[model samples]
Target: MRRDEFRKAFFDASDRVHTYAVWMIRNREDARDIAQEAFLRLWQRCETVATQSARAWLLRTVHRLCVDRIRQRTRRQEVSLSMLPIDSFVDADATTDWSPDGDLRGDVIRAVVALSPEDRAVVVLREVMGMSYGDMGEVLAQPVSTVKVRLHRARKRLRCRLEPLCEKRSVR
Candidate 1:
């Protein structure tokens, strides 16, 4: 990609790429680092990655980096809720009630965090990022059908985990 094209792509996709990284890694600093690294990689491969597909390329790169980071966290057994601020779980565009009495946000975050990295990625890409199945499949390197199945399974798992909490909150 040319300099001008690269600049345009950066302007257009930086927020989305950073958001995906944040949701995947659940650490702002780490997410920033991952986003930087992904953009750097894109720059390095500018000759190879077409400008039109830059966002998808960045997403795919970000996904791979997140998976590696998650694996490292797993091996070290160092994952912690303290590392992920509760505020990061809030969706700016979401219409869900944020009031204290109706807030199951913390429970939702916990449930999402408990998901395996692959499942979490599927959830973040589909539900949070609002990517279509074909786009998600490209990012995940899976078939579209597989992406749909994974998303369905992830949502079901989240529902199962959060249903009790929702019920409890409703009873009060």
Candidate 2:
């Protein structure tokens, strides 16, 4: 791709790529690094990657980078919520239908963070980022059917985990 085309692609997809990284790993600094690395990789391969597919390419790259980061965190035995600031768990502009109540929001964030990385990625991509199953499948390297199943299972798991909290709030 030419410089102007690359610039347009970067401007168009950079925020979405960064947001995906943040939601995947729940660490702003690491997310920024991951976004930068993904963009750098895109730049390296700009000759091959089409401008129309740049966002998807960036997302796929970000997903792999996040998986690697998560694996490294696991290997180091340092995957703890306390390692990141409370605010980093959920973005302020995220489309998650979180209530204004901080406690409930915290509970919801905890439930999401507790999910396995794959499940969390599906949830963020579908629910938060509003990507279609086909797009998600491309980013995740899964079949559309598999993406649907994963998303369904992830939502069910989240509902099961948060049901009690909702019930408690309703009872009060």
Candidate 3:
């Protein structure tokens, strides 16, 4: 990409790239790193990257980078709340049980974090980022059908995971 084109792409995509990274990684600092690295890679591969497709390309690169960092976090024993076993995270310290009386947003966030990273990625990309399935497929390197299926499954899992909490609220 020419410098001018690259500049335009950067200006248009920097916030989106960072938002996607933050959702994937759940750490602003790390998200910034991923955004920077992805942009750097884009710059290095500018000759091959099409300016018209730069946003999708940047998002895909950031996703892969986030996955790699997650792997490293596992090795270093700093796995995210999202990677924790649902049961383990829910029952940590055994100090309390989840109830509607507790903060609903916190409970929802905890449930979301307990999902598999892949599921979380689809959810964030499609739902949080409001990307169409085709766009999500491009960024995630999945076929459109696969993206649809994964998103459906993730929603089902989240609904099932949160059902009890919802039930508690309704009962009250």
TM-score winner: 1
**Could you tell me how far off, in angstroms, the CA of residue 171 lies in candidate 3 after the best superposition?**
2.7
lDDT of 1 by residue, 37-107 (tens): 99999988999998888999999999999999988988999855546766566765774666433367777
lDDT digits (tens) for residues 1-172 of candidate 2: 7656988899999889998898788887889999999999999999898878889999999999999999999999995563454466556788476644546787777788779999999998987789999999999999999999999999999999999988998888
* Whole-model alpha-carbon lDDT for candidate 1: 0.86
Question: How many times do residue backbones clash in model 1?
Answer: 0
The TM-score that candidate 3 achieves is 0.81
Q: What are the TM-scores, per candidate, against the unseen true structure?
A: 0.89, 0.87, 0.81
lDDT (tens digit, per residue) of candidate 3 on 111-157: 67677879999988876689999999999999999999999999999
In order, what lDDT does every prediction score? 0.86, 0.87, 0.83
* Runs of candidate 1 exceeding 4 Å displacement: 91-96, 99-102
Distance from true position, residue 170, model 2, in Å? Answer: 1.2
